[model samples]
Each structure stands twice: as C-alpha cells, then as structure tokens.
Target: MKYRIGRVLISEGQLREKVKELGAQIREDYKGEKVIFVCVLKGAVIFFADLLREMGPEVDAQFDFLAISSYGASTVSSGIVKIQEDLSTDIHGENVIIVEDILDTGLSLSYISKLLRERAPKSLEICVLLDKEERRTQPVNVKYTGFKIPDEFVIGYGLDYAGHFRHLPSVHIAEPAE
Candidate 1:
C-alpha cells in the first residue's frame, strides 16, 4: 500500500528554526540545572535528536526514551494507551522534559505525564513539535509547541502513516495515490 504526499504542511527550514527556538528557551529556563529529556520513542526520535542538538553544549542535559502506543497501524489513535517500553532511570528529584512528536488526542501523552509525575520528578513539562487541537479529548499542558497544525493526516518529519514517511525532511498532508 503506497501513499502519496500532498501539500507541504511544514517546511524543513521551519522545523529547524522552531527546534532552535525551543532549545534556546529550554536552555534558558533550566540554566545551571541538570535536566533530563524523556523522549517519547519512535515518532519523537527525530525531533528529540534535533532538539538536543539545538540546545548546544552549554546546557546540562541527559536523555532517556519511553515508548507508548495509542496508534498502531491506524491513522487515528485506538484510544488505548499502552506502555511499550519504560525508562531505565529513576527520575526522582530530576528536572524532566517530555519531548513528543505531536499532541493530537493527548491520550498517550496524558498517560505518559501522569506516569512520570508519579515518580516524583523535581519538575515535569511537555515539549511537542506539533499540536492538532481539533481532536483533543484530553488536555495536555504543552510548554513548548513548534506548530499548531490543522486536523490532517500529516506524514514526514517524524510523523508517519503506518510505518512509512517518517524519514522525510518536511511534513506533508498524506494522501492515497491513485
């Protein structure tokens, strides 16, 4: 099942600029403090790496990965959040940041935040690359947002349909090829 890329939703340049901005803001916000960036796995991997590089070398930062699945092969979430993988670190008394690819229904992220909060981190916040608020069923306090996109099945730039289109440099509206 091949898919076609339609209109460009987010350009690569825009992604780079936003990543740099988010990184700078986070660095300033946690200056002189050690921070742990907890990356939501698979989808958030690219954004997390770019965000970390954007933060530069000055900010004291560590990273860990946590994987949760709400959407399997479907475009819409299944509404069932499951922890596919858990973080190895304790995170107690540590400043924690949850880096996510997109905040759509917020079910998965909401679950993630609640689970992390239970660990008693010194601070916990969310940083997301995209926010599709039209379908939001749960509220998530996203501290850093790169873009507020309309409700569309977007692909590329770490967002994917099924397991494809994630390697593309820019985001695009996904469509079926005739």
Candidate 2:
C-alpha cells in the first residue's frame, strides 16, 4: 500500500536512536526505584518493545500491557475513554510508566494517568513515542518523548489508519482519497 499524503516522518533508524536515548535517561532517573513499565496496547507495541530494550540498568520491576480505546476505527477521536482490558498487577506503591504511541488531544492519556493514580502507584509518568504538539488541546507532561510530529495523519511502527499501514518500516501519511 502506498502513502496517501506525506512521506515517512520518522524513519526506523531515527526512532531507534530516540528510544535508546529515552531509555538511558529513564535508567538514570529511576535506577534504584521499582519501575513498572505499562505499555498501551495495539498502537504502542513496537515502540514499547524497542524502548524496553533500550532502557539501561536492570530494574527489578514488572511489565504489563493495557488495552484502551478512545477512538473507534476512524481517524477522529470520540473523546470517550474505555477500558477493553485492565492491568492485572496492583499499582499500589509502584512507580509506573504509561507508554503510548502518540499524545494527541490528551484526553485519553490524561484520563488513564488519573485512573492509574487512583490505584495508589507510588509515582506515575508518561512516555510517548510521538508527540503531536499542535493537536494537544490539554496539557500533558510526558517524561520521555521520541519525536515531535506535525498535525498529520501518521501510520507505521504500530500506529495505523483504519487498521492498515502498521507494518510499514517507517512512519508515513495516509494518502488522501481522491
């Protein structure tokens, strides 16, 4: 499948380097803490996998995947957050990291953050693969960010357009239908 709009925004190599850097930073900041890496599912699988490998200093922590939904199969966000599957681990007294593909609109991520906070995690922060600065309507502080993206539809490396283009090696815009 060919791209509809722009070319690759962030190539695979570029993504790798950024993730490595973020991992190193995280390792330094939370060296001795009990870090629980919680990756958001579907869109963040690839980013999480790469990032987890990049993190330095062995952490005696746990890893879990949270499947959440704020958007349907369309490009537009519905703004309603829902939990398809919840985390099995109790977040009590744990430093948790919520990893995601992109931070746009901020509703979903912010809601998730607050929800997790209620579980009594010792600390919680966000780490996103891509940050669409222009699309952020609400303020969200992500501890780790891989790239700052333009306000364009992107797909690849676990992000998709109607469930397609996720297999692309790099990020690409979905060509508009004429």
Candidate 3:
C-alpha cells in the first residue's frame, strides 16, 4: 500500500500568508487579551509552531500541546477520538484556542471541543489549517480557517498519510504510488 505525493494542494507561500492573516484576525478578535493556544499534537504541531511565530512578542500568547488520535496507521480516521496527552494548564476562565491541522469528519475536534468546553474556559474556538467540508459528519465551528480544501487524501505541512510526508513544506495530495 505504497503512496506517492501528488500535486501541490496548498503551497508553502499560501500557508504562510494564511497563517499571518489568521494571526492578525486572532489578535483583533481577542483585543490584546492573553491567549492560550492548545496545539493538537502530532499533525498540528508544525502548523502550531508556524502560527505561533506569527503572533509576535507584542501578543501575549501562551501555548500547550495535547495529543489526540483517531487515525493510527491508516489514512482515514478510526472515528474514535482518544486523548494520548492532555493539556497541563488549566483553561478555566481563559481565552483558549484549539489549533488543529485539518477538520475532516469533525469527530475528533467535536469531541475535543466538548471536553474543553466542560472546563469552562472564558472562550473556546478552533483554528484549522485545512477544512474538508465534504467529509464533515459532525458539526464543529471553526473560527479561523487557512484553506477550504476538496475531498482528497492530502499530505504535507503537518498533514500525513500513515505517518509520512508530514515534514513537506507544502501541502500535496496523497495518491497511489503507481
């Protein structure tokens, strides 16, 4: 079941521009308040790092990492969200943002949002680098969206297929190797 990286779906330049825009939007929305960015681990780590840099020193942005897994070694999600790691910081009464790599069926993020909301944060929102609306099964609100992509198995830029291609600078479709 080998796979090959296909055409660029989102270029590195596009991602950088979108991240900057999202950072600006977040700064404006939060209005100089402190923000706690909870990075969804593994896939979102790369996007999280790049996004954080956009925040700059002027913005009081704090960050933590939590690992959630629905896809093990498969391209498609297993539909069961599991928390491999949890955030150490208490999010109660704080401006919290969940940064994710992609929103597909929306199961993982929906589950995560529900759990976080129960913690009673002052605000809870989602920021995703990619949104695949065609595959959304659960309704989840995404406050910041980098790109609305089509229904394709995409890789690169923190997205991956069976744990490969996550380090690629740009996003690419994951197609059959042949």
Root-mean-square deviation (CA) per prediction:
1.1, 2.0, 0.9
TM-score for candidate 3, residues paired by index:
0.97
> How would you encode candidate 1's per-residue C-alpha lDDT over 1-178 as one tens digit per residue?
5578889989999999999999999989988888999999899999999999877677789999998888898888999999989999989999999999999999999999999999999999999999998889998999999999999989998888888899999999998879
Q: Score every model by TM-score.
A: 0.97, 0.93, 0.97
Q: Mind giving the per-residue lDDT tens digits that candidate 2 earns over 140-176? A: 8788888888888888989987777777778887667
**Any residue pairs clashing in model 2, and if so which?**
4-174, 4-175, 5-175
lDDT of 3 by residue, 33-134 (tens): 889999998999999998888887657899998898899888889989999999999999999999999999999999999999999999999999999999
When sorted by TM-score, best at the front, the candidate numbers are: 3, 1, 2
**Model 3: CA > 4 A from native:** none
Please identify model 2 stretches exceeding 4 Å from their true place. 1-6
Instruction: Give the least accurate 10-residue stretch of model 1, judged by summed lDDT.
Output: 52-61
Q: Give lDDT per model, in order.
A: 0.92, 0.84, 0.92
Candidate 3 residue 61 Cα shift, in angstroms, is 0.4
Measured on C-alpha atoms, candidate 2 has an lDDT of 0.84
